[model samples]
Target: MKQLLLIIMLFLISVAAYAQKVYSVDYQNQADVKVFVVKYENQADLKVYKVKYENQAGDNNGKWFFTDYSNQAKKKIYFVDYENQADLKIYFVEYENQAGWSKMSKKQLMY
Candidate 1:
């Protein structure tokens, strides 16, 4: 009975861990995180690279695989009209090797 309970608990934990749902709000006030896309990698607080597969996505790392549907996304992001409205500013990098958070303080925004 204890083993069965432990297995069930583990399953619940795993499910919760994968429950990264992302929604893009039309307004900045409705968003949990504000984002900015920098024109250059050097100007970014976090350098991001889009992955081809969801399995390749990392924790608070710039490896993002955009889901075809919003429901399937782990992190919902809304692109604000202005830089000041964003909570987390990101720059898309050309190379996967360049993907990462330059400012560690903003790392929690992704997770």
Candidate 2:
């Protein structure tokens, strides 16, 4: 019984250690957008991006950015450090199919 209990405890600990979480963020102070802080166990990197296609210069590409300076949702494609959770806003933009960075707009972001 002692060995069995030890095995069970080990299994639970391993499962808890390997779990990863996803967060949703918004610029509002209200509860409309589901936002949560990420606490990494160690040195790690988390990326957030929007996957979409739009006609621009006759090309296509996958799009992703860390965080832009402003939360206006209408601006260029830029990345800023992820600091304040309240300033985070989901921005969306259109880009050439599989091309690269293009014009970023507020409408391009989502949950």
Candidate 3:
């Protein structure tokens, strides 16, 4: 039972570790993920929430922090002018629980 519990814990840890670490890039060409901010929350593929602490960010939960340097970020993202040009369309949610990916296929774009 202990071994099974350990395996389950490990699986959860690995899953949590896979959540994309995001960074804001200066230029679009330098970014790994291109994002667009949608006007309406219903139109967004992902709902984002800015977290107060960096440690709180995880699990497609939209906990984001704007890092000062590019090197400090895990996944460098560029904000695009048009939604059609973006790899992911996001809406900033006021509440943390409201943040999550609406499109499962687009999840890979973050990682």
Per-residue alpha-carbon lDDT of model 2 for 1-111, expressed as tens digits? 999999999987653332211122343332333322234312112123343221111111223322233342222332324534422233233332332223243122322
Q: Model 2 residue 55 lDDT?
A: 16
Scored by lDDT, model 2 comes in at 0.31
Q: How many clashing residue pairs are found in candidate 2?
A: 14
Give per-residue CA lDDT, model 3, range 1-111, as digits (tens).
999999999987865654545778879999988999999988888889987766777866676766667776667899999989999999998998888988888877765
Q: For model 1, what is the C-alpha lDDT against the true structure?
A: 0.73
**TM-score for predicted model 3 compared with the true structure:** 0.80
Cα lDDT tens digits for candidate 1, 1-111: 999999999987664444344556566565667888877777678888877777767555677776676667656788877777777788987788988988888877877
Which candidate should be chosen as best, given TM-score against the real structure? Answer: 3
Question: For candidate 3, what is the total of clashing residue pairs?
Answer: 0
lDDT of each: 0.73, 0.31, 0.80
Better of 1 and 2 by TM-score: 1
| Cα error of candidate 3 at position 30, Å | 0.5
RMSD of each: 3.6, 15.4, 3.2
Q: Which ten residues in a row have the lowest lDDT in candidate 3?
A: 14-23
TM-score against native, each model: 0.73, 0.21, 0.80
